[model samples]
Target: MAPRHHEAIIVGAGFAGIGAAIQLKRMGIEDFVILEREDDLGGTWYVNHYPGLAVDVPTTTYSYFFEPNPNWSRLFSTGTEIKQYADDVADKYDVRRHIRFNTDVEGAHWDEEAALWRVALGGGQQLSTRFLFTATGFLSQPHTPDIPGIGDFEGTVVHTTDWADDFVADGRRIAIIGTGATAVQLIPELARTAADLTVYQRTPIWVVPKVDLKFGPRIRTLFDRIPLTQRAVRAVTDAIYAFMVDTAVLKHRYFRRFNIAAADLAKLHRFASIRDPELRRKLTPDYDFGCKRPTFSNSYYRTFTKPHVHLQADGIERVEPDGIVNADGSKTVIDTLVLATGFDLWEANFPAIEVIGREGRNLGKWWRETRFQAYQGVSMPYFPNYLSLASPYAFLGLNFFNTMEYQMHLMDRLFGEVRRRNATTFEVTEQANARYLDRMTEALGDSLFTLGNCASARSYYFNPAGEATLLRPMTTRRAVTEASQFPLSDYTFA
Candidate 1:
């Protein structure tokens, strides 16, 4: 069949994808298309509609650096508000027209002869492009635990990523599994309405108290009228968070007091909120805060104080027809079962859409047989003219917006190199990819993820080899600078 073609093809219309498109337009490259699997613009936000769903990061730091939202209703935005921001940005930049919604990519193969990516779409459609950018985020894929009787759960089962607007839980006996970020955000909301809410937590997580406030009209008016004033607030917020990440989360030594203090604060909050000593112990994390993803919630600890809410530490052994069997043989009848269990981070590397690199180098096979590593966490050694955003070890701390910015900077540079050389293809050399991974691996060996009291957090942060793979192991500032200084000579373009 004759296939459609473009100068550039991007997958996933989230922050990474939208940023890449905007940058490409700015560089006078408009022959591009953004393919989104969902029928909407927002990527993660559009998918998740769970109760109490809101961004953990502050609005000041979460927004795009170029398009700061001076009109955020709250300090941290709800999922609905955040999704609207994404839609607004797309409309403002006129990138929405380039987006083909509900177009799912099934596979992508690098065409050596044509120097183009042969992208196979769902429903027997196909496209070819000179450059293929995969912005399919790491957290897009949902993961339910491998429990024996989960399928036979005769009650209402809901995954956080697939929550429906019409699904109701009020006055129902709810059993929610997992105590990660998603679960943490959900418990407080469920406690308020559910007849009885039992949270089956396998592992406890460290929690920092969240301080949220409404952005009053006075501040909103000032921010919208005077852009510089809002810029100052955002800058100050950025500086404060950057320091917290560098001193506390990044390093395992040297004023390790910061990590300890943060943990102590969490413990104190738990102590103050939870009256029962045994219950507090069950809620406390044995590992350090930064081992797993650190979570912020003002009402999470306070929720347990309610008589309607229950916390189970032994976790769910199996699911009965209408109840969850705890490891200790206790069973709680649940009318509704919600799996707030988050996404499959590792599986995201394989791409729901398959990718075949040069010389029949299958992307999935390479990741499984060899380790998952990328040159500066963007380009692989074998994938010419391909850029993978939000790649392994690419997440800079917890600030996704900043991480995407750093990645886009690298992408902008690589696109520039492609234009300058008038090259048909570009990929990182094997040696360069290896060397960059080696340095990062060494530095990661000493970070809080490996050490710092997190021996058995069972965190998604570590891969099967017990090495940290999800985080970049550097401060946000440094990660951006490193991406900016990428040696153009490192890539082979021809």
Candidate 2:
């Protein structure tokens, strides 16, 4: 029997995938299916249920423009609230009806002769589609460090993304590894309940105070009643974040002093908990502020002041059933081990599903050889009718909603072009891809995120080729504007 098919198959139900499905419906393209590995609709939010899990940006500007939520409990919504918003949006748009949850895409093969994407699903299921979109986010896959003898540990082991519900840390010794964004949030939560906590840090990170506030009933009522008032607040919040964090601290040269000054303030923030001068120095990062992803937390620093907390700067040597051994030969016994090591980056974190393109070529082969280049991060060469959300040098500013919305507009234009040409395939020309990357490379050389102290920090922005290819490297406005425009001649149709 022939397998089921659809006009398009979207491999995610997160913000990007949901946006694609909605836009497809809006464009009068109804025959589409969304494949989600998880049972729930929310992608990252669905997987991650750790304590103190919240978005870094303010909720006012952090959500979808098409469907804004005025009743956010806090300026920075918690993971629970974000997941609820995603669910609400899905319900409002009738998106869940088209979604196949628990359906993992094992692989994708492009049939050049048939002009269709043949995707392999688990349980020997197969489906074909005219187009395929991957929205698997970078941070969706939790990364556990490779410590020798890790399996020998008898205690409960957990990652922030896969936290066990019934595992209580109260009256238990807990040791957490890694100090990235997840650890910064999880440390404070564990410190409150655990009898003793030992944190294993590979490197130092700079942290600033989080600006979070609860919206009172009166404020929420005003926002709900006067929609324009909510819009005004969102605009103001977007402008502040765009200028203060992206433009002033990370992008523009003239305002770089703000970055340096902010680092000094972080040092002061650490001094509040760490009174010892040497310990304070240990907390300060040796590299520049923006080298690695900056975190916002008020409790992270203060949690260290607890008498039972131990911060280990040394690396891990091995793990035993009874305890963890440090590089310095010191051992600490714990009841639970939480891996806050963050995710494998960019190319390393690419979707595990196999993707075969033109002439029987696969995405892993082409992308590995070229080191992740594409036309505006959406369309790739030789990959006809294929588009993705988080591609090399295609990601825009901090606001993820804005980034997805910008890409959706670009996708609309490309799909329209396909309709106009009456073509089954649309792949970027090699010359066009090179030209775009050439100009992008030159622009990236000037950005502090790339040309500055990021090299010393071993940031995920840099790919396996030792090039910073994850970021778009342009101002948010310019990047989004450029993403929308495409010379039809740049793509070849058949």
Candidate 3:
């Protein structure tokens, strides 16, 4: 057994990790360690450095409840600005002291006899903790496409997540693979600098106008002076977005109207800006609006109008000696290639870790064939004194941080009860978890996400049995209400 110990151990230093640490402090749980794989605290923001990368969500709703940025420069800050925000949050909360940078949590196993988690790190570092919190995000792992001859290509290749600083695209032909969210943001920025840019498209995404703007001096002063003004504004914005999604899409007969409006806007935007009819059709999305992710951008359509930028709709056949080859036997030679393929949102990410609960069964073995199942998206049946923030099916509609606040309150009350009752652990019943998973599957079947209009053939939302196990069908408000109050009777405390 390798040697450090603490009351609690968090596996990441991102929003979820830091947030959990803050919650622990408030609960009077002082002994904790936060382990981050990278040498920084921003998590996903710290890694992805492609040009023009920014938050599609408005700034007003993305901030934490404890701190709000009164002087946000833009409605949607760029990647660098967002990274700076993460740093500021760390500094403000004094959370840096609790973090161990460049240390990866290699594996974690439960010591059944001791009723503690045995955490292991790379290079033989080990620790035992009463509770384990996994803040490792769902989207951090980049899904590198298994294309033929990708490794054989002679050109400079990079992923959008790990962009090199010294890499220059000036006066050189650059090939960009996958026209997903990252590609939409980076394409416009590359079009301005690269001598020639070729974007290989697998499928077109539904593009929406981004209502982005800088906060004026007046608004900043109002937030700084009134203080509560910013909070009120954030609350209102969150409510509006929540209501709009619920009334229009969640359970509505008029949901198709919203889709029609979005489609019409895309058509109008495509025809008005792009002159080539052939290019227009290639850019037009065949999938239903909101079926897949809806990208928001102002310049994505206009970028295609530039003479230096080209979009290849034909599927990529293989990577040639220097560049990408199309299915029609056409080849485009370029100096550099970038893959923005996306992330691995598979359900087996956690099960890949060897976590043994109270019983002798390994978590990986239990979830080997089935998808991930959790009660209220936070608790597993066998795992006691353990919780996961932003777990599968728990991603909030408006702000994830807001949902986290609710979860923190719930855990605080549960732990308080544990202390009061002189209990060592709290474990959910297997029947409850099974029931929740059944409801989750039934709800997703009727939701817009399960519709066959997604751009990709395969989805990250389902299991091998085609059950929707990764997403929650409940509204943000309802989820918080149900999860905020943890019932003691549901678990067998010891």
Model 3 misplacement above 4 A: 252-254, 347-352, 455-459, 462-465
- Pick the TM-score winner: 1
Worst 10 residues of 1 by lDDT: 344-353
lDDT of 3 at 118: 88
Residues 167-229, candidate 3, lDDT per residue (tens digit)? 777888998988888899988988888999999988788787788888889989999899899
TM-score of 3: 0.94
What Cα-based lDDT does every candidate model obtain? 0.85, 0.82, 0.77
Worst lDDT 10-window in candidate 2: 245-254
Ten contiguous residues with the weakest lDDT in model 3: 245-254
Once superposed on the true structure, which residue ranges of model 2 sit more than 4 Å away at CA?
245-254
Tens-digit lDDT string for candidate 2 (1-494)? 88788999999898888988888987789899999999988898889889889998899988888887988998988999999999998998889999999998889988877889999999999999999998876567667788998888999899887888787889889999988888999999999889999999887888988878999998899988998898998989988877765654346465677777878888878887678777677677887887777789998877877898888887889999988999999899987898998887654556456788888777877888766776787777878889877778766666778778778788888888889988988888989989988977876655666546665666776777777777776666766676667788888987
Clashing pairs in 3: 424-494
The CA lDDT at 163 in model 2 is 81
- Model 3: how far is 27 from its true place, Å? 0.3
Clashing pairs in 2: none
Give candidate 1's whole-model lDDT: 0.85
Any residue pairs clashing in model 1, and if so which?
A: none
Say which candidate scores most in lDDT.
Answer: 1
